[model samples]
Every structure is written in C-alpha cells, then in structure tokens.
Target: MLRSFTKYLFAPALALAATATTLVVAAAPADAAVVSVRVKGSLAARTGAANWFGKTRTIKNKQKVTVTCRVSGQYLRGNVRKTAQWDRTLIGDYISHAYVSGNPKLPVCAPPAPAPVAAVPMGPTGTMTNEQFLAAAIGPAQQSQRDTKVPASVTLAQAILESGWGRSSLSANDNNFFGMKCFNNAPGSYAAGCKSYSTQECTAQGACTTTVATFRTYRGSVDSFRDHGANLKSLSRYAAAFNYTNNPNQFIAEVHKGGYATDPQYTTKVVNLMAKYNLYQYDLKV
Candidate 1:
C-alpha cells in the first residue's frame, strides 16, 4: 500500500519540481527590461505550450520578435519532442525558446490580443496559358515520375497549381517550382536552404490568408521535383500516401491527408490540371 502511494506521488512531485524550477528562473526582477529575441531559424509559433497545438503562425529567421512571457513547452530537439522552456510573443503564441538566442531577459506580458483570422481570396489569378506552364515543367515531371513512383501528372499538376503556372517569383528565380520547405526532411541534394516569398494559404475551413515565408530554394526546378518525391517517400506521415501508385486521385488525396498543401481545393485543382492537360499519358510512358 505504501509503495503504491509513493509511486503515484512520484510523477506529480517531479512535475511540480520541474514547474517550480521553471517559474523561479522565469520570475523577472522588478526592474528587468523586456526585449526581443532573434530567431536562429524559421520557427513555428503554436497556439499553446505544446507541439500538438496548432501552429498559429511562423516567425522568420533572424527576425526579432518581442517576447512577452515564458512557459515550459514541448519542442523537437532533433527528432524527439522534449519538455523545455518556451517564449511567448506579443501575438500570444508560444515558440520553443531553443529556437531563439542572444536576447535579454523578458517580463510577463499583459493578456495579448486574440490573433485575428486571415482572409481568403476566391477565384482566378494571372493569365499565363496552361500549355506554356506545362511545356516548362513536363521534362522534370517525367523524370520524377520515373524515379519516384509519383505520377508525372500529379507532379506537373502540383507544380502548376503551387507555382501559378511557373509565374510565381519562387519558381521564376529560385527554381522552387513546388514551394517545398527547407525545414522538411528533403534529400540534401535538393534541400539547399529557405527562400522568403509572399504567398497565400487557406484554413481547413477555407479562409485564405496571405503571408510571406521562406521555403526551400533550389538551383533549378528539377531539384524541386526531386525533393517533392523525397518528401513523400522519406516522411513517415506521407508513407501511406506514397504507396498509392499510378492512381493520381488516390495519391494526391493521401498526400493531402498528410497536409502536403493548404489550399482547400488542392487535390481538386491537381485533378483538374491533370485532366485538362492529358498529363496521365506521360505516367503511362514514363
């Protein structure tokens, strides 16, 4: 009976000790000056103090964001998420403190304003002909189709949709036709680093918001194609999606389930692009 009681108390006692240690360290002096912390890399600011929380937004590399408070949270130290200290921002989101360095101590913040919902844009953009875009991307798509089990149609379609028919600046300059991220487990051959570009995203509820962010930049579009394949193959979350070969709809739907892209109509758009372009025929040949 005594052993059972001691075992039950052990966990709570450890938790309390951890919390007390954190609270003591974070308690600011009365004259402490508040300051901003520069992000060492792109950081996801979560809705709460846990990695499981929704990423409320992102902070850019080397950008200084004002820290309002500190709390203990879970952060990925390499592949493992561990209990560690976190810093809250003026936006009321929590970022793992490990992502920031070279900053002064901070003060507890006032209750922050609720994060505002972002707007969505509905309908068409640009006047680039589909043939023009298809012509540019088909070469890499065919090669990718052969190499990865991903259909050329799906690859081409995702490129067309994400890159605005190769008109988006990330495609034009960075050769990042697919908007892949540097933070992902991309093969080193393709994962050079990140590039900042203004882009749009949609919530699951279909509300769209425009924001600028850094993504994996590449020497050419082929790298983007290859990395897209790598992402599907290497990431465990995408394994189920990668297995549905030759079926574009099932393949895209599975990737979508793994949260490949944010546009509410992503799979629909890819399917439409494939249909409109006879892109599936290449899959048969390649």
Candidate 2:
C-alpha cells in the first residue's frame, strides 16, 4: 500500500509541474504588432525628430503608413494643439502626431521632451511710429473717404492695423491694404495681379490657425485705396457699415458688428487708433 501511494504521489507531482509551466507561459506577455493607420492632413515625414529643418517628404492625407513605434518630439501646434508624441514610420522616418490621429494603444518608447514654446511673432507691427504710419496712409484714407461713403478716419485706422503700417508684405508688395482676398480665389483680378499667401485667422472660439489664401494686388497705393471703397460697395451685406459714414467711430462699430472682420475687438482697435492719432480730423473733411 505504501509503494502504491508513492507511485500516485509522482503522478500528482507531474500534474502540478505541468500546471505551473502553463501559468508561467500565460504570464509572459506576447509582443504587440506594429500599429499602422491612415494619417490625416499633409503630414511631413522628416529626416529626424525636429521640424525646424523641414520635411524630407510630405505624406498625403489619408495615406497608409506603418507606425512602427512612438517617441516624444517637438511641440507642433497648428489646426489642433498637436501632440509632442512622434510616430515612427516603417521606413524609420518621423511625423508629428498632430497630423496623424489614430490609435491610442500605440507604444510610447520614451517620454516627450517638448520644445520650448515660441513667442508669437510681432510680425509687421511696431516697425514704425504712429506718426510715420499716419503720414504714409492719410492721403489714401482721405481719398477713399471722398470717393466712397466710407469714413476717412475709419479707413486709415483699418489700413494701419491691417497692413501693420505698410510693413506687411501684402501692403508693401501687393499693395493690399484691406487684406482683400483674390478674385475667384485666384490671382489676376486687378491691375497689379495677386499673390497666394498664408493667412492666419482667429476663430470664434479664439483658436488661431493658418490657411493658404490669395490676396488682390494693386498698381499703386492709391489704387489700393480705390479698391477698398469698391470692395465695400460691392458687398451688399456690408451696406449697413456705410450707414454712419459721417461718424467714423459709429461707422467702424457698425462694420465690426456687421462681421467685417473675425476679430472681436476690431471696432475697438480702429476706434482707439483713430483717437490715438487724432485721425478724427480726416472724418471732418467728409
């Protein structure tokens, strides 16, 4: 009976050993498959992690690419607050997570060391004094006011703020004082031609983004002033903006309320500029 019990003990031991082996096998995790998805927008595949050097190649929207892995990368903010997580392609290239939105389960190989936030540039503003800007624009503003029902003070203020006192490339080169878009969304509408440029606009929610836009060009500064009047006159919906032409302050406020610009403080800016520069004097000429 003792011998029989020992034989049975070995059988039980073997069974326990097999069960332990199975548990061990189950505990060991399997390697995950590399993730791939169709990335949206014109995502640039770069030679390295940073975009400061530019892209090696642009990946088309909705194009398929294997996301071999992920790494922390530079802060690339655009239409969306882009993630600093960089996706590694099958070809060992990198793309910003901003343009590629897909799997959350993708492996992160390292913690992201985000680049330092860049200062929003003071592009075309502050290059000249208010006096300088007024000197350059007062003539055009007065002429446009005389020709069109638009107020001279309001026009000058808008030109100063919009064109950054003629420091903006559009105003300096294309002579687009109002930042008027190109006709038919392409160039060749006016005498001087047009230019396709990148435009940044503020949304209602206060989110700012960039988009490619074409703007009308002019033969000269006076022509730009003439077009401003025509553009306002042509827009039937903006007729209410012309109602208070005798009152430059009132006119700017009305135009702002009528959606002349996306900026919420447009009326205030124009009004303040007028006061600061004593631009109201021009309105009296009308």
Error of 1 at 275 (Å): 1.0
**TM-scores of all models?**
0.51, 0.52
Residue-by-residue lDDT tens digits, candidate 2, 156-251: 888888888888888878777788877675644344776788888877776778888778877676677777777776777678877777777887
C-alpha RMSD for every candidate: 21.8, 22.5
Alpha carbon lDDT of residue 168, candidate 2? 87
Q: What is the lDDT of candidate 2?
A: 0.67
What's the lDDT for all of these models?
0.68, 0.67
lDDT (0-100) at residue 275 of candidate 2?
94
Q: After superposition, how far is residue 171 of candidate 2 from its true place, in Å?
A: 1.1
lDDT of 2 at 87: 69
Candidate 1 residues lying further than 4 Å off, grouped into runs, are: 1-129, 184-188
Model 2 poorest ten-residue lDDT run: 19-28
lDDT for residue 99 in candidate 1, whole number 0-100: 39
